[model samples]
Target: MKLPRMVYNQPEVVQPVRTDVLIMSPWLAPIVWDGTYNLGILNAQYRQRKFRVGITIFAIKKYTVFVKKFIESAEKYFMVGQKVTYYIFTDRASDIPVMNLAEGRSIAVLKVPSYPRWQDVSMRRMEMIRDSSHTRFSHEVDYLVCVDVDMTFNDEVGVEILSNLFGTLHPGMFGLPRDSYTYERNPQSEAYIPADEGDFYYAGGFFGGNTEEVYKLTNFCHKAMMVDKEKNIEAVWHDESYLNRYFLYHKPTKILSPEYLWDDNFGIPAFLKRRRFLAVPKNHDEIRNRR
Candidate 1:
């Protein structure tokens, strides 16, 4: 692919972008944040490739109410100008709302059954994604990005996030000591990480990789959940626990800062330049039917 001559400032190796936050991981992977990379350069590089990105989101039962807002906000902020296919997994396809999507963006509904518990609903995503990756996602898209449906985009989530494999920092878990990280501690479950072991507790709400890497990840997590089920053990945080354990060993090619996955409960800190994607405030007991 011939990249046309374009005027942009040459990157200076001596001067770093954000001195406060860790710009690079121990493994040399870039920790993405605002001011880290030039969007013009990234957009031109990726847009020329004509990449196909498929984002997976699940809206089932009570979660259906979040669909319209998610789609509307997504249309305004997510992967603008890229070929995006939102593979929405929902029990009730009719309940999924329709909206005017932008050019090169569309939606595909994958009908699934509703789970009895909200925990099951969240944990089952690994299995659902694994199966879909094998039969559908692999052939349809170059990359698979997954996110929780209950959240909405607040800022640009563009090609800057695309990588061979990527994980977002858990908003509540960041800036805390490793010991304080809520990694699964049960030795019996496959999601267990030893007391002294952990890199970063990742947000399961958002993560992705190329088709092959995502397949390998979801496959491992799904099978681990099955083993725990057979032994009558469930990890403390469901899919998120499994995800943390996986990233601990596997490591991601790129890591997104907390800006990509902030909780609605917390105020945006001064250090954060962009509040990209955020959790929509909701009552846990009321929405999940915990009552």
Candidate 2:
């Protein structure tokens, strides 16, 4: 007699999904891309940390001397190590320095199609990051930083801020207060701010979080843009405001400090910024060494 049909069960195999570490940057200003100088400090900070670090620059071909210098510096100083990778996301990746930075390890070059419009331009910034964040390489990153290329790492302010936030890794969001908004036009924008109110005005320059939160935030930002389109609001600089609104309304996690973020020249008191991210203090020798 034929034996009863045997039942076969497939073995349960677990496939670990991977993630990539990305530092998203708009690099709009040419002065901010000096890779070697920035990397010297970034490396010092990250060398002791336990995460892979990589940078993403949008529209690399338009890079000026400052931008090119930074890109080249990043290529030379931040070349791929076991844990780091540098990515250049542009419409044309053919001649861009994707390989020079990859060194021996795998370097990624992602070409995202372009668009027009100020808000759309900012959206492109997020798109480059989102694309990289969701790619196969994304799984390698425990966390990701959305940064502005113009900002330099005078010290490892990036890592210091991240360390503080990671230590408290609450289910919340963080950002720099907007440079005081004193609008000469648009009564609506002016009336929007009360003179005495000191609510945090999220600056879009830098922010980061677990890959999951970042994905969610970017997705929200994209959808919000669609809403703005429908409503015919044309202010392109409102991305940061949009984020500030979302975080305030949602009340995820609040990491508020200026140390983590300072505008090109807006010098908020060091103590205020230091509450969240500390500036590297000058040692006695260095202080005395200063002429």
What lDDT is reached at residue 121 by model 2? Answer: 53
Residue lDDT tens for model 2, 45-105: 5666577555555543333112344454444433235355545565556655433435433
lDDT per model, in order? Answer: 0.91, 0.44
Q: What ranges in model 1 sit over 4 Å off?
A: none
Report the number of the highest-lDDT candidate.
1
- Candidate 1 on 232-291: residue-level lDDT in tens? 999999999999999999999999999999886788787789999989999867878632
TM-score of each: 0.97, 0.55
For candidate 2, the per-residue lDDT at 22 reads 13
Minimal lDDT window, size 10, model 2: 27-36
Candidate 2: regions farther than 4 A off = 1-50, 64-67, 71-82, 98-107, 163-198, 250-260, 267-291
